[model samples]
Target chain A: MSVSTVRPDVYAQVQHFYARQMQALDAGRFADYANTFTEDGTFQHSPGAQPAVGRAGIVAELERFHERFADDPVQRRHWFNHVALEPLPDGSLSSTVYALIVTVRPGGTPKIGPSCVVHDVLEITEEGVLTRSRLVTHDQEAA
Target chain B: MSVSTVRPDVYAQVQHFYARQMQALDAGRFADYANTFTEDGTFQHSPGAQPAVGRAGIVAELERFHERFADDPVQRRHWFNHVALEPLPDGSLSSTVYALIVTVRPGGTPKIGPSCVVHDVLEITEEGVLTRSRLVTHDQEAA
Candidate 1:
């Protein structure tokens, strides 16, 4: 049973945060995307994989991931759904976000690429919301 | 630009409703799953595909889908994440739910199956919450 204690605005903010993060990644603004996390943020791309810790490390890892589309003018968009947020005992919040990545090849229709999900541990403070740790899991058959 | 006017309780209810629907399907309780929709509920398995209209039709379609594993006792579970809800202009709420289906072959570890997303138009009336229409889309390469 889930309680309705979380404010509606918080949900909206989280959604917006994800949207902006996706936009930044799509636009090749890795720095902007990395800035959404805390100074010591952690990003794990898959199970049993090492996480990219700290903003600099996250940016580096993301850049490496983007290398595939570097030469080509590929279009990328992330669609997130089934987002669930829960309060944590550490005065923070956790969110489970399911995502679908769509890629458009040159002069081709958009095709679904990967089905990914992120478990985000977020800290909300007066300074603003920050993602402390995010563990991402995706179908191994992602194209 | 989204506004946070929707009640938090609505989000909780939508999440719970989806959970129950998935549970019923996994348990092979087709009737219970069908009951989650309205009298004239519609379910679209893929974009531009013919939908199963009405509760009876939904039940029939779902039963047909389950026929593949009818001979064997297959384990099924659905994981839904990143659920986004927005208030629509027609007084119905819209939800974008990302779902991953996991299938466990007899005596094997669970493997991911189709990764799909459903955009559901929900009606919350005094009678109860109902799924008016659901549009599902998925990766063409999904197995």
Candidate 2:
């Protein structure tokens, strides 16, 4: 395993990338959120789960998510913390972050949905940094 | 109103600094947490709240916090996101982060406390980055 420090600029780039990506998703901009990933990017909900491959597949999954919550008036916000980035030997970046999903309904208290850890492989391109793959694992499942 | 992009390394530095500082506090290492600030640093909970001045004063306030939660068996975690940093004319750094405080008791669901924004003036010291001043404002208060 190669362990190298990630440069500051790279860290900032990844941070900004997620900040923009999550904001787009939370705001219901499915296409914009999917664009943050590579055309062939994959999103796995958990280990052994069928992955959403490619931009269209990713957008389909997000649309399903929208429909699933269509009846709910609650707002959901994704907060990422403890973002640790590692420079891979292939010139990509391996990033791990704690993902907190907070949901709030009108005039109701905010609730944390579940504790999760997101692992991402990011590649830099002429367009900026984009996630090549992402896998999210619930804390309970990890235990 | 200079809006310069923060360098990647500087962004990484600030992220690691907060990660370490928040972990120390959540772990109940009050003194270690207070040491992340300068000797004469100030911590204001809100706009009109009296600030805790100096390391000793900070520790004293933390001790009060410890006592307040002594009877509770809940674990508290501080998650920070959307960290925006700016280089100041005086060579300091201005940092603003959305702070989420999550609390979970054994076998209970996790809940988010109040939403907050923390603003800090950071100075690069020989020992790395240290907070010179910190002010936290609740989201409701801002509205």
Q: In order, what DockQ does each candidate have?
A: 0.04, 0.18
List runs of model 1 lying over 4 Å from the truth.
Answer: A1-67, A70-143, B141-143
Q: Give the least accurate 10-residue stretch of model 1 chain B, judged by summed lDDT.
A: B1-10
Query: Could you tell me which residue pairs clash in candidate 1?
Result: A81-B81, A81-B82, A81-B83, A82-B81, A82-B82, A82-B83, A83-B82, A83-B83, A98-B82
lDDT of 2 by residue, A1-143 (tens): 11236666777777789999999988989889889989899999788789999999999988886897798897889988877676789999888777878889999998775766689999988789999999997654423
User: After superposition, which runs of candidate 2 have C-alpha atoms over 4 Å from their true positions?
Assistant: A1-4, A140-142, B1-12, B20-77, B81-108, B112-143
lDDT of 1 by residue, A66-135 (tens): 8886777666667688679998888788899887876655545556668888899988765456789999
Q: State the C-alpha lDDT per candidate.
A: 0.77, 0.82
Q: Which candidate is the best by lDDT?
A: 2
Residue-level error in angstroms, candidate 1, position B4: 3.8
Docking model 1 quality class: incorrect
